[model samples]
Target: MYPEPVWTEWEDPDDFAEAFQLHVERHGENVYRLHKAITAQGFKIDPQTLYTWKRGDKEPRSATGLRVLKAIERRYRLPDGYFSSKLAHSGRMITGGGLEKLSVVERRRLAWHLPDNFDLLPRAKRAEILAWVRTVIISGATDYRRYHANAVLHRFSFRFSEGASPLPFPKPRPLEERLADEGAPEVGRPVQTERAPIILDTEARDLRLFKTATLTTGGRGRNGVWNDETANQKMEHLGLLFGALAACPEGEVRGYGAPVRCMTFAVLLFPAVWDWYLRWREIKRGFFTRWESEMLTVVAGLTRQGTGWLRQSPHLAGYLRPIAGLITPADIVAATEDWDGVCETIHRHAIVRAKEVDRVARVHRDPFEPILTILEADSPLGEYRKISEEVRRRRPDRRRFPVAAAEATRGYLMIRMGLHLGLRQKNLRQLLVVPRGRSPTPERQLEALKRGELRWSDRDGGWEVFVPAVAFKNAGSTFFRKSPLRLILPDLSGLYDEIDVWLRLDRKALLKTQPDPRTFFVKTVKNKSNSGAYEQHKFYEAWRSIIQRYGIYNPYTGRGAIEGLLPHGPHNVRDVLATHVLKQTGSYEQASYAIQDTPDTIAEHYGRFLPQDKAALVAQVLNQVWGS
Candidate 1:
């Protein structure tokens, strides 16, 4: 029997009347009521007007207008694209309007009107605004219009404007011209001024503001002051003031704010200011010199002695009195000729703490070795070897072995796989063996191994475990890619197959303890008491224990365990693979392609052909070529 078609009609006709009628019938009475409601809400325009919107006759008014249209769609229970034409028109209008001209101040006002939270705009948009503001400032666009634009940018945060409203000029000027003008004084003669040590009452307000601003901006912290861009700006202003004062006659330096003097200030102030300016120049090219004026004011205040300063100054003399004891012949040579005796005296007195400075420099100079050692020795591979050796020596029975041996092996596997794959602990825990469709569980461990598909093809050859995006730290939609260390090993395919067999055998019993079919690593009785089932912390502890057991010392660290391995983590395996490939091929380009590493990184970390192993590697290669 033929079924009768449902017939429905829209009361208020529009360009999409036929489609709307069809949609109303398909969606039922609830949708029809929604359509009527939307039409009643002043959206019941003529069909031709709707058609104009659909056919690009007009544009959408604003983002709000688009939202209104979307609301209508929701009310009528329409498909996503049902009112897409109207929404898109609205979008075009808004996009065009966004480019409309506005003065710098107006722009700032607009930006202020935007949501207060940081995340309101996309990162790219924020970056664009930041870049634009920099460009405008660099271009010396100091007019009211430009400043208004700057104000708009400043509305995003004080960090953007550095707490000052954008400079307002009546018109744009060249950077050079602006600098020249700024350098010139407004009056030919100096204003009435007096030079005196800083009085607590007079300088108090400005000093307070300075301290508050510095603290609020994250300048002062436990680690010492952070020399950020704003600090650099201040330093430049100081430099300018210093230069100006130096040029001025000694007596003419009259109107200085305060006279404060401390030896530490005398030693550090100029250098610190210079360094800040240098760093600022490195980060941003051609920031003009307002720093000199500001720095002069600070210096003036430092010349005054507070009660706190008076108390602290005497302590400094005794503290470094033994610096002379530490001075060496090399230190004498390094010291300037004029200051050599002074330097030696400082070193002998123990006043300078030179060794501490040297130690800090050394650590900074070579950070890679220590950091890698710490991470790797505490890794899974190191742990595994430890446990395996323990079990082999003990030779415990099968029941006890499962409890001790299997637990150890599992920890090792997790660490090994995690480092090799660079999977975060949570994602590593969530890893599952993708099953073949229409297949039931098999009793055979080897069959289960064959069924589990969790591997990826390597660049060189063979397969390694493939870590999907869900398992990655970033939680991206795309899979996190990595190549296996086996690719660089001799008989790569054979080694991979051996690892596969090893995993299958080890996981066989553990598989039976799974709480759900989707869970990959099943908890055996040994690991049942472990928190989170597969916690990374447990893996770390197990690794540390294994390192102590195996006594594997890194040659670099003179310490036992995998911590000696350079560039730790799953990535280190890749580094090792890349290093070996470079050695084997003796071709930088080929090695780079094989391991997918940059030439620079490879050269820096992996390219060094160890002196001890060089002869043996070459001999082996030569023998292979000669059929020895």
Candidate 2:
């Protein structure tokens, strides 16, 4: 016996364990008594399970686990969510909730989003519910999204491992020898055409030096070094270039079948090599795309005289191995002996080739294709807000699905911030948060880190976002004039309340016990991944996921915010903002201010102010005479 209960006033428990223990003690009962009472009430829960729950060793995860907590609440004469609300959002898959019909992977993903009474529902009803969740939430059923899902599976680009320096990869067996050993492919099956390029020791070093170094060892004739992101893009681009060069012509890639051993960086110095590669790309793609133009631009920079990487690094010539038609043995000798003259010749050829590629470079994929519904609207920003509304409408139950609820809240704020700030993806994901009543991070520190901060502003009486000029990709643009970006976030549409709730509860739920990355938006912490920070690809996926789940309409299930909406990323928000202003004001200057860009940039890239939109604006003003 627990010695007749004394009147002890306990502080509110911060968690399920504390709450459970406090209630049991206040009632002057032990776990055995509590278990017996629950059993008497027709609920069979393990005595040890009660002990574990009391001890904070485990709380509840599955529906059964939750039911046991409900029974305990009833025994204690507490509210339905008394103990349940205090449980941590473990983010682990919640099973044993009538998901037996689902595949193991499906069960893992759908468990958190399922209703509490999901198991009790009829078999046909469960199937209907699952179909909706799978289509709208998991698959993001949209035309473009479906296409993207399939497209990513057929990866043709090379992936350089992180921290991969210019060093020799393991020597690959000759293609013919390896193929013979594996035997011939079946008639119907697709043949493996492109093997990862086997880079030599010299070529790898040159590749490294070209991308990472600020200046060549000699420190002459170069434009600039590539940033990490740019460097990665270049590596991927170059990988595709090399992969196409090495792929078998007979196979699907329809590539040149150049010897893997001879595919050195030196091949880039030859005019004929560039010509062959350029022509092969055009043939493969069936039209000129920006890819060809971008690749040519990279080549021109690499081979440009006085500062070109290939020109400055003469030793690359020594590594050149002849590819029968592309590079003759004599050409290699000539290039090695007269590196400067050969570079000068190739540099001129590259410049001429780049101009030719640009003339025919068709826009392969329209940037606006995904969000045409939003962008084509008279009020694009107004139309875009439907996504946030949809997110709020479809938000899950917080007590039962804390992590999912937090994720929904985060998605809402992500769209809100993107609309208000129009900051690039890097600037947005890296933006830090300092809650109300806390001292803001110093501007100098933000500039040093090249990130922005969202903080409470007592003077402005609203939330303020401050990012240094140096944080922007276009820091030197005349729009900034070296001034930092400062904007007071409008406290509208429950924006302030949402931010406060996120900081107080939702954000922490997503982080769990993981170390806070200090960023406003965080990835849901799981066992496999502990960090709460958003990487580039993960961040892009997060934005796209939000759009997929809420933005695109599905006629079959009758969910989503907009009809004909496709999956797009954070960058598309800038287009939305710019176009919105352009439609209203008909001034590129005002439109530029919306996204912090120059009028020329808005005219050329951002704003989609069609001739009709411009004419309509003029007609609206001119028609004022008829109204009078």
Candidate 3:
């Protein structure tokens, strides 16, 4: 669904007859040939009408004229929207795999509507689809045998039938088959998975020792005027050293004194040191993000510089601060052993950021749009009756309902919460229907879902969700911040009512085999633990998988809505909610509270209100004061 190019010079002029005559003068000889090509693309306008318009006897009026212009633009490889006025629009683009250079509108469309499913498709099949589209453009047709040529696949129903659809996943092996992930190449030495794993290597184990931790300057900031309270920290910066040792390519861990290892260790400390002092150096966070931490882990593994950091070039200052001096060569020498916390932290950060960076790097893309549109009122996000009928056609119920129905319901409910509330991944994962009393065990939660008698906090009134302070990213940090404030789950009546049905039907059915499903979300396929929480990584992967398999991505951009036809990262929910609230309310105070941030902070980053909004706000207040 590529956007129709907007002709900047000719927006709503008196008449397009002048523009039509000019086009005819330039393409006098080729006009008839272009007419034939346009006809091939399903434009049914008579050639006589085209000549009449070009000769100034009649101005072009039908949509077919627009389609002919598009065909001519492609056939001649003309500058995008070159001969366009406000009138000409084909509603399609150059239809081959190799498109003509993108127009201004096309660039915006590509940035916004790059299909999430496009990259997920297999290389050969992707070529086939692209080639099919190219053929359709040449022949000016859409239907071909059993398949249809759509710029973006219209529905994911074609997904199951695609037979060769390439999902971006290693085929899932049953948990038993992956006991050791035997065939996968070791990234560094193999890591552990047991809760509280022990890193067998000795140098890394030092992080757990009390002596390895240092008592850094405590109480308040170095200057009391800067921060309200300065709490001293007892930190084990040795884990920072462990980051490099464990991150090295498999054989390099033991060769700590090697020049290459020395350089890698120093390089690792540079970002960690720069992280503490330079506040806004990182994106979207007051402090260093897990992305920085993960970047260090990758630098250690991939780069093989030999003590180049010791050369004293001013360039080194870009990464290293004076604090890096405290981490000496001996510290690197002593860091041969690996610890569980160090490895797990590095690995988890790597996994999370890998997905995060891809979307973040593409500044304005929203890969979640198609799915979100389908979730609108009366679509899958609500009663899901349309989706139910679709599924029921293909799936025979094995139990009370088909497995497809259960998965679809659960997925729809999860996405709806994200769009409506802007909840974070962890916040969604830690949700509890058994309210704020003594927390419910897995057995109790399971029983509650099945019986439909959830332990509501009648004290706080029913359906109150208590988000623990520990869930905040800043929870354990002693950085500049305000008092911890607990957030109330936004009260949306019909929304919570949907949760009731999900728990009773979808969730219960998914976990029916598990003797104990500890968390609200359980694994679709059996893995390690009997029934455990859906980890953040798994939650995002599932969301993406479901969206690509079931929805559509819009080709048009500039909808001026927050969520559109493409899928986005789970973290973007907070952004979508904050920006949307600001656009609607025009108050930073309202946006801050909605996103759980300070007013200044919300204005600095999250909100995207227009300048006109401020002018409107002033008028609104004056009207309120004087009774408009």
Clashes of each: 49, 3, 19
Per-residue lDDT of model 3, residues 1-628, tens digit only: 1223333233333234555554444444445765676777776888888787665555433334544665665654455555443232112223222334556565333322222233335767546655543332122222321132331132110001111112222232343332222222224442211111121112122211211223212111111111101110111122323332333234322212111112222333333333322232233222344445444434332222221111211122122112222343333223222222233333444445445544443323222233334333222233222232322222222242335456756665665655554555766665545533545334444333321213445565555433433344434333214333333344464555555666666666666666634455554645455454576668877664443333322222111222233433466556556655665577787776665566786676655555775676567778897874
lDDT tens per residue, model 1, 534-628: 44444344443433322333222122333333212233334434445555655556545533445665666544445444565567777897884
lDDT of each: 0.35, 0.76, 0.40
Model 1 bad stretches (over 4 Å): 1-396, 411-431, 435-464, 468-538, 551-575, 587-596, 606-608, 611-628
lDDT of 2 at 475: 83
What does the lDDT come to for candidate 2?
Answer: 0.76
Ranking by TM-score: 2, 3, 1
Task: Give the poorly placed runs of model 3, Cα more than 4 Å off.
Answer: 1-201, 208-401, 419-421, 435-455, 459-461, 476-493, 527-530, 549-564, 610-628
All candidates: TM-score: 0.28, 0.74, 0.41
Residue 161 in model 3: lDDT? 14
Over 333-352, each residue of candidate 2 has an lDDT whose tens digit, in order, gives 68868988888787778778
